[model samples]
Target: MSFCNPIPIRLKEARKKAKLSQKALGVRIGVDESSASPRMNQYEKGKHTPDIGTLKALADELSVPLSYFFCEDDISAELAVNLNKLSLSDKQKVLEITARLIDESKKG
Candidate 1:
């Protein structure tokens, strides 16, 4: 079965979260200023897909993890973004907390 590509949705969300216009984000990610707006517009509209290198550039520029673009669910995607904001210690704490939650849920 073909799952709908989530990039477009998540890209738009990330772009908006960064308060960037399509042209601005495109330019920041190294697309030429002349074609930036149209190119980013196409990606957000799902008419075109950016390659992995471009996506990596985008994730870096947008301050999100590259893996966030490919998450299968919104909750996981949002969690990835939030987790990216944590320090290493905080992330380990989150991991411990989540594992405890999972174990508790399994026991019930």
Candidate 2:
């Protein structure tokens, strides 16, 4: 019901879409798997909030942009639709080219 609630809901949605349990996601982000479940539960229930670093780590682990959590619009659905518009082969080619360009840019 509050603005803060959307962040956890979006995180839960992203984690589920990625087929990751809280423990698995926590592990990916270097948190203890044992504690992750309850922590995520708190997050979802809005009993606790994650700091910026944890949110960033969660976004990275979920392979989503941090903006995915903050955007008031349905950016994830839009991204999904855009990705669906791309052919699988074209997607791979684009990723490869983009990676090379990023690497070159980093070197410059």
Candidate 3:
């Protein structure tokens, strides 16, 4: 699937995880309150894609990294969410461990 294919699925997932209704998320991301639900619904339905700037605002409001919306699978998307909770040093440690695991798997 195209990279953009994951976006609507991940957007819906993140919005749900944040416990937000479509309207609420849209409003929080600066859409007019009156039009928020319809706008967000269109996005979730993949009928319209938000621009990068709007996506960034949605990411900020939902407390997820913008990259989360582009992850190709659920595991990677979930990893991004968990990774966002780490400190800079801790994140570096995770990257090191992940790389080591990949090397070990490759060698075995």
Candidate 4:
């Protein structure tokens, strides 16, 4: 069996996490419903890569930042999700906390 590419793996995981079937995600992103299933299947199989516009649409429809797709690790992806859920004030607080943690790590 062919090893899955990271993009395809991430796409499938995010789609499932959002509780969308491939056809559902395709239609939500404005693909014609008739072709949605095959189109999304192609994407998830790494047979096709969506252009940036389509990628942005997918990200928006899935309620995730586009950066989530490019993250190299699950931790980074999870961090992106958590950070995206924060309000501006809360984001700043998170940054401050992260900075403090980094400083503490350096000291210890």
User: How displaced is residue 15 in candidate 1, in Å?
Assistant: 0.8
Give the winner by TM-score: 3
Off by over 4 Å in 1: none
Residue 99, model 4: lDDT of: 100
Best first by TM-score, ranked? 3, 1, 4, 2
Please, what are the lDDT tens digits per residue for candidate 1 over residues 12-58? 99999999999999999889999999999999999999999999999
Window of ten residues with lowest summed lDDT in model 3: 1-10
- Scanning candidate 2 in windows of ten residues, the lowest lDDT window is 76-85
In terms of TM-score, how similar is model 1 to the real structure?
0.90
Task: Specify the poorest-scoring 10-residue window by lDDT in model 1.
Answer: 2-11
Ranking, lDDT, top scorer first: 1, 3, 4, 2
Error of 4 at 100 (Å): 1.9
User: Which lDDT values do the candidates have, in the order given?
Assistant: 0.95, 0.77, 0.92, 0.90
Model 2 stretches with alpha carbons more than 4 Å out: 1-4, 75-108
TM-score of each: 0.90, 0.64, 0.92, 0.86
lDDT of 3 by residue, 1-108 (tens): 544578899899989988999999998888999999999999999999899999999889989899998999889988998999999999999999999999999999
Question: Which candidate comes out best when scored by lDDT?
Answer: 1
* lDDT per residue as tens, model 4, 31-60: 999999999999999899989899899989
